[model samples]
Target: MGITQVQRLSAGALKPLAALVDDLGLAAHFQGDAMLNGIDPVIRSPHRLGEASGTAQLLIGIAGAAVWHARTGKKTDIAIDIIDALHYLHPTHFVQQQGQPILVDAEHVEVNDIFLCRDNRHVMLEAGPPYMKLLKGYLNFFDCGNSKKSFAREVAKWDSEKLETAMATAGLPACRAFSREEWLAHPQGAALGQVPVIEIEKIADGKPVPFQTPALSPLQGVRVLDFTHVLAGPRSTRTLAEYGADVLHISSPAYPDTFAQHIGVDVGKRCAYLDLRNADDLVTMKRLAARADVFTNTYRPGVNARFGLLPAQLAAASERGIVCMTANAYGHSGPWAERPGFDQNGQVASGFAWKEGEPHKPRFSPVFYLGDLMTGYFAAAGMMAALLRRSTEGGSYHVTLSLTRSAMWVQELGFLETTRQASLPERDSYPARMTSIDSVYGKVSFLAPPLTFSNLALPNASRLSPYGADVPEWPA
Candidate 1:
């Protein structure tokens, strides 16, 4: 099996939203008392229409020392393992690895700890007394802008040796930067099993017909390893699982469980946690990949390959398997590949931000990660096609789909056409005549004053539910 990167949810202080998930019996599988902290209430709250959903979401940011006290009563040493996990997740951490000198922000709990703590492998329980808590609180109240001035004296007093000691406590590792392809090409990558596909078309009246259904159920026995998180990636996988892919979610011990619960994305899948940093955990992931036919993740290109879940690697492990079928707001190439992207950024880039909804006054809907989600579905369809090809040809295929590409497809019909075009006026000359308002918006409205078609049935002899509805027997 290849060395794949995995993250875990923090065992630090829990946030109010995380508590809500537990109280509501959501994420019941997350048994660890280690709290999920550092959630911004504005982002986490569900009160605002289409905005805050007061839902528990996966938070990948740093935690404050006060977070532990805010939720947990007992004062305990924060684990170095937790710190290491945060370092890998934090954007600043990545910048530092590039040898960029970052003027550490003492106001930021994680940043402060990076300067104060040294080792990267120790457990939080081993850290000294409640000092971490006091420091966290101080940072919380401290003026963020004046961090350099506020921490100047301490910074001066704490020499290189003291800083080294603190660094030792963090238990972090210096990973050599590897390209996405290099990461995917690791020898151990041959663990995830093959993904197969078959093409089927409907036949009616002794002729081939397009396949369509009241409810689409194209995937039956297929299994997916849902490694992607957040609304876009999760919702995409959820849609597939809803239709019928046996989705097994692989999560980091470091990410919040409430994220899946609040968004209602885990409904059709079995979820399990894995720590990618641990050798044994990587083995477990490989084993799971060995059985999973498809794998979806949100990490930008190189990240997954470093931990070993690349398409080539997956194909090597399982002949004809579809390894990486996920969407990146930004295409996998270009200078932006290393930078993180989200739906908002994608909207801005796709020109939809300027022209959508109000003219010159673009307003956004509550569509979190719509671009990624749609891209994911399109990617899923492509994977299905590739799987079919592999089954017939016995060769592997790499499939990629992007939101930008999809947006272009959407715009093509109007903007990039070669055939004769029809001009659509802003307002139609005939309002009632042009539109069949009834049944237009998923409502049962009278059409043409309830026209009685000559051949229409006189109505059912009796209401279908006249004898009362058949009650479903669900377990109490």
Candidate 2:
């Protein structure tokens, strides 16, 4: 059934608050089956109307306050509480002020003004008018039923005329929007095309190669110099590594170790560090790239390129030929390129935030980094293909993966045939499935009969042997 006009109007009202919604990461909680089952009426009802206004503003405000306090380093309990809630938002087109608390407001409704005390021991909330006070509470603004209804009523009054007025007077932020047709018409549709031939091979000890097409293995023999920090870039290279490429990860002295701790996919790699700001460090990195078949990095755009890491600039460093893979939350072309971003911004820009379920519920797993990881995969794939072509035909290659494009690419599975004028089958004889493997301490084993099928499956966590000192050996 078609959505009612009221639903559309509600969606329009909720548009301005989309950033906040993405920030909180609440899509799965607000939609379809979830709308019927999720909790909290205030955040849930407007979600029923297909909009998430009050909930969004509430989250954005809370996130702002929590992020603000993270800088103070003392009395951070309050900040920590909200900080976890706020992490769901990423790829934001903004950077927080280094030493200040974030203040979030919407149409004069101040949702939060929280402080992370300098001592890093506690958290405090500045008071707000009662109507706007819910922002300081649980990151879920929809928890306050009265405030949610009130916010919904306020949003219902916003329409195209009101938006046009805001744009005309407030100087709305310039953002990119692609029509369904425009996106389909993009020249790189060839990249999205799916070739029909398939081959599944057990390549790695515990990994299965699924759905091999002529278009794949394009990244074979390419060695990538990975200078990415955090989940996005590292995860990208992991995908490349999956495609049978050697990836050397270079960290910086200033880099954080949290990524390696929390992410498991990066288990099979080596690491090194270079302080790129130093002359010697820069020289070393350049030399490494000279031997690298590809270079991948994800620091805001132009920051590294100026130091000779960008595609055009890296041409001078190639010894074995290089394919540079660059990833950014926003594409290099936008006003927001230099602005800080994470998955949150991508979710917002790509319409994932809007369709997300039950407005008040915070989004889940903004951690996916589907774009960055896939971009890494595509980058590796592209570089491999480019390298093969170079060997036979010859030339340098550059590949770009944008958070925005990657976000849109997620929908390609459903959109390709219609949008790209490509042929795709409705079903497959060999469907893509996740196989599970187990490990007992350091030894890995699979749950199968003596005679098992060939295919590498993703490893899963299993109970370790608690044999206390001397452990018995398993028979081969």
Candidate 3:
């Protein structure tokens, strides 16, 4: 999509809020102008950079507040700051420890960057255990070692497309960067653009169960079962936790996440472990789902189906009905639906990386997983809307979102071009944007929630449990 095409997308991005309200039959209750405040020309591009993201955040907040009103007959003003929204998009960058900024290891970055191949094309390789294993395999395929230099040298020996094909065959997460024209013409990209940014489907029928209004917050008594890992899905559950939902995050020992990645997003939730492969543990998960009001996951399209934990299955297991929200890297459609992906892969496959840097050298967007963050915010909004629908209409809902679709929305929103230099906030300014909280590890500083309401405050408690620290059962 070009600048002109993206400009047209900006208007389309804002239509979701109205469509959501209409879809849920809540047009009568929702009132207010859906506008974002305090956005300027800081990060320049062809699209409405700040407005697009800020508006999505604002809409989610409003939707949450609207759900509150639906259950309690109380209305609240919703607002979001563009700067804060942008900051929330890259929370890792703004996180601090004691008084210093926490730095990601250089080796981590070196291994995860876009590399030039023999054909003069660029491919991104996200570095980690499985990725590193795949990188080693690719190197071995080319008769190379496991060092960064060796990986780069071997990558340069193969054509970009050839390497991408080999990595895909090995079920690895790697992709060759595509230009805007190339991406739009690609089948995956075309399918992605057609997918809704958020799709809420009524999967099962049930009686309307009105949520009890709480003295503290709208979601105070709600139970959210989080089966997400990494950034996007975790961030969505964290948003619910901030609003007073009892969020229990489930993971397995087989899949481990670094403290650096989990610490920022794990705040305000309980953590537990359940090995689904074990029949006993699978029974425990189903019991938890039976009592859960909402369930969220980031497992690729069919992985959950193998275990019979798909959204429809979860809804059937739960008596009170449930809201199931899921996200993935590519999308839930197209040839790449089953393909494993991440923020970097989405950036490369969706053409965002190509536009971020110069014509010759495409750099991953410096904004840091904006695609994942926005998807989280969008998921939160969609989940809230689904909740409201269940309260009124009575049915199980499945809400779907993806990193690639969010990239498309960002592309449609386009970018803002300014000669002004955009720099990070000063250390002194960090105090206002960040809050200190006690965790199992120790004191951690992280960014505050981006949205605000006139009636309720987001919980300030930031205690985080160690991975699998709690029992699998939900609170009695």
Candidate 4:
């Protein structure tokens, strides 16, 4: 609301904007079809993750062009309104169904918060209710009257490093907090430094194929096999669906998402359950992948390989070419690649949590979501880039991402505290940004997208479905 009329990047692309993006390896993409906008501070954090929200928009702009190019051999100009994108960090906060919120139980005090250890170091131990059965092995202080305070006391008994190692050994979720300087020196962090935020590699060969059918959105008819959970991975496919991709979100009955997580990210998709451990479900997921143009999985790094769902393997799943993408907790390489991770892990390991320490708390950031939400856009951008490459380069591709990698990029955006008298993006911006759609769950409201293209429409008209509400098969 501060400025209903946002400026365009190309005609008035400010030089000050380069400070955050110069090192991101996106100048080339920026120079390409993407024309970035919105260089103002919108988020409340002292960190630049919110101000750099435009980076996601830039990626979305580029993806929009790629979708347009692949869908119809014609070029198009895309404009991104970046405010609502950062709002997506906490999808449940903004979304509502039939006046009732879809909620994942958020009160897992024993499993969800940060605690101090004997090492005097901070570590976030996370195994949300949905993941407790999945990522096991941790302190067993479960009590008749257990509280966060009680859990903190138990956590303090273990050395931070040892607890981190123990959790990693058992494939549970936890990480020792690192300051920016510490992150640079840590072995796993060092390994992360060697890679890009989003990795898009051509893994197989296929002929270029352009869409012949007419469509209202850039990704219309594009089939996306979404085998993912939680915020980061699900948000990626949801963005793809907004572009008109036919996203099929699959999950297992054994490990279910919170109702809020399902409702927030289920827009414009077919949600189904298929436990890969089961012979028939495994076959079903593969069959869907075989017909998909995009394949995404968010299991810990190597878990997909066990099910024969590796990028290269799935790249060969379709002859027409597929954009295969994956998300892990840590970076794609190094000691922590196989360890499970989540947004909090990224926040802790990438130094954001430490930097966010307050006078009352040594390490904490209320709920800043750059790690999870923008990382989703990162993977989505990678998939779009891979899709663009497929339409022109004639090959199948693989895109990789991790929570830490995305969080690191946010750090690279530079801290906003250094800027002059920065306040939050205008509260007035809210009313203009909210978009309500009538779906299966009454009038559902969520943040609108930060991008627009000439003559193209957002897929908001599509209804949101409940988890596992649809069949596994693609539409006939």
Name the top TM-score candidate: 3
Would you list the clashing residue pairs of candidate 4?
Answer: 81-450, 102-260
Candidate 4 regions with alpha-carbon error over 4 angstroms:
1-8, 11-38, 73-76, 80-82, 105-110, 134-145, 358-366, 418-432
Q: lDDT values of the candidates?
A: 0.36, 0.37, 0.74, 0.71
- How many residue pairs in model 4 have overlapping backbones? 2
Tens digits of lDDT, candidate 1, 38-146: 2211111111111111111121111111121222322322211222222221111121112232321222323222122123211111111113443454344332332
Candidate 2 per-residue lDDT over residues 1-476, each given as its tens digit:
11222221123433423332332232212221101111111111111211121122232222222222222221111111112112212211111223221222111233221112222211111112222222433224223333444434332343423422332243221122223243334332222222110101111121122212322232334467777754456655655554445556776656433421213334324456677788987887787787776677777666685687876567555654565666666565444445444443444444433333223322312232334434443443344433433443344566556655655544432321122212322111112112222322233222111111121121222222211221111112
lDDT for each residue of candidate 4 in 173-233, tens digit (9 for 90 to 100): 8888888789889888999998888777878887886664676777777899998888888
Each model's total of backbone clashes: 41, 30, 7, 2
Writing each residue's lDDT as its tens digit, candidate 3 over 1-476 gives 12121211124545644565565454566654444555444354434445666767776777777777776677766666666765666777666666567643322654567888999899887654234555565555757665668778878988988888888787777788998779888888888877677888899999987888654676888899999987889989888888778999999888756666677678899999999899998899999998999999998756698788899899888989999998998888787777777777887878887887645577665565667788898888788888888888898999998888888777765555523434532121323366787655667788776766777566664768999899888777
Ranking of candidates on lDDT, top first = 3, 4, 2, 1
Considering TM-score, which of the candidate structures 1 and 4 is the better prediction for this target? Answer: 4
When summed lDDT is taken over every stretch of 10 residues in candidate 4, the lowest stretch is 16-25
Specify the poorest-scoring 10-residue window by lDDT in model 3.
Answer: 1-10
Comparing candidate 1 with candidate 2, which one achieves the higher TM-score? 2
Model 1 CA lDDT for position 142: 30
Query: Where is model 2 more than 4 Å wrong at Cα?
Result: 1-221, 257-265, 358-369, 412-476
Evaluate model 2: give its lDDT: 0.37
